[model samples]
Target: MRLLLVEDDHMIGEAVQELLRAESHAVDWVPDGNQADAALLAQRYDLVLLDLGLPGRDGLQVLRALRARHDRTPVLITTARDAVAQRVQGLDAGADDYLLKPYDLDELLARIRALARRAGGHSDEAYACGEVWLNPVTRQATLRGQPVQLSGREWAVLLPLLARPGAVLSRAQLEDKLYGWGEEISSNAVEVYIHGLRKKLGADVITTVRGLGYMLACQPAP
Candidate 1:
């Protein structure tokens, strides 16, 4: 998923950003509230990891502003403020989840997965298209009940397609999912990954919409 990380501390932000990238998520990192607001305005993200004590504008203010504009992008607050009132304030200000500072990285990742699943309206951890099944949290894929290997880029490309089967995602949209800000994008990067996915999961597992783009094919392979 493409995510925006709003964090101030260099160490923490760098660590978290690398961790998310290792998990195959495309992340854009900003250090303060103003930058966060700007990023939000300029781009669409699957989720936002917000830090409450922010420079320029407060995190709560940023979140309130996002909600005020009726942007429903999920915000997960990660802050050092441990007070119950503070947590409540963050939630009331429109944070979808809150994580205290110095929390376990595993827990953080789990929360992200949970939020993604909820945002996609999926109650189950696994997503299916025809004979293919993907477990996002586990980063595992199976085809016809057998395990299949997929590269990190392949996993990234397949995720959004599985999240909303049958919905057409344009090449630009898929590229957005595969890359973060400032990352170089090749002309046919999406096609390369799509071709790789089809080779592993079966050609019929994904359908090309010609001029439109691509979508998960739910029909059984012939």
Candidate 2:
């Protein structure tokens, strides 16, 4: 998933970026609020990890502007201020979730996954469509409870499609999801990844809509 991290603290931003990247998430880190706004304007992120104590624009103002524009990309506030009122204010200001400073990477990741699931109205972290089941946090893949290993790129493509099932994701969309924007996309990259996914997860898991794109066909078993 693509993430936009808006944080002024250099150390914190670096740590978060490293962690998210290690988890196969593409992240764009910005120090101040203006840069954050610019980044948001440029790209559509799966999530935004925002810090309230930013240098120039301050986090609240950014959140306000985001809400004003009716942008619903999930925002998780990571700030040092831990007062109850401050938390309430941040929530009221449009934060989908809050994370106090001095938190663990695991917790933050859990919240991010939870937010993604909620934003997409998932019933559980273990997302399943037909016989395929995927656990994003654990990187676990299963077919009817039996483990199935998937390549990194395969997981990346499948996760995004699972995040919003039935949505036809074009090749360009999958390219961006597999490799971040501006990265070189080889002509056969998407097809190769899709072929690998089908080989491992079962051919019927992902359906190609002629020229429309790939969709995770959701249906009940007999």
TM-score for each of the candidates = 0.95, 0.90
Q: Tens digit of lDDT per residue, candidate 2, span 2-80?
A: 8888988888888998888777777788999999888888889889999998888989889989989999999999999
Which regions of candidate 1 fall more than 4 Å away from where they truly are? Answer: 219-222
Pairs clashing within candidate 1: none
Candidate 1 lDDT at 59 equals: 96
Q: Residue 8, candidate 2: how far off, in angstroms?
A: 1.9
lDDT digits (tens) for residues 1-222 of candidate 1:
899999999999999999988887889999999999999999999999999999999999999999999999999999999999999999998899999998899999999999999998989898887788889889889988999999998999888888777799999999988888888989999999999998888888888999999999884233
lDDT for residue 38 in candidate 2, whole number 0-100: 85
Q: All models: lDDT?
A: 0.91, 0.85
Output the number of the lDDT-best candidate.
Answer: 1
Model 1 worst lDDT window (10 residues): 213-222
Best by TM-score: 1
Give the Cα-based TM-score of candidate 1 against the true structure.
0.95
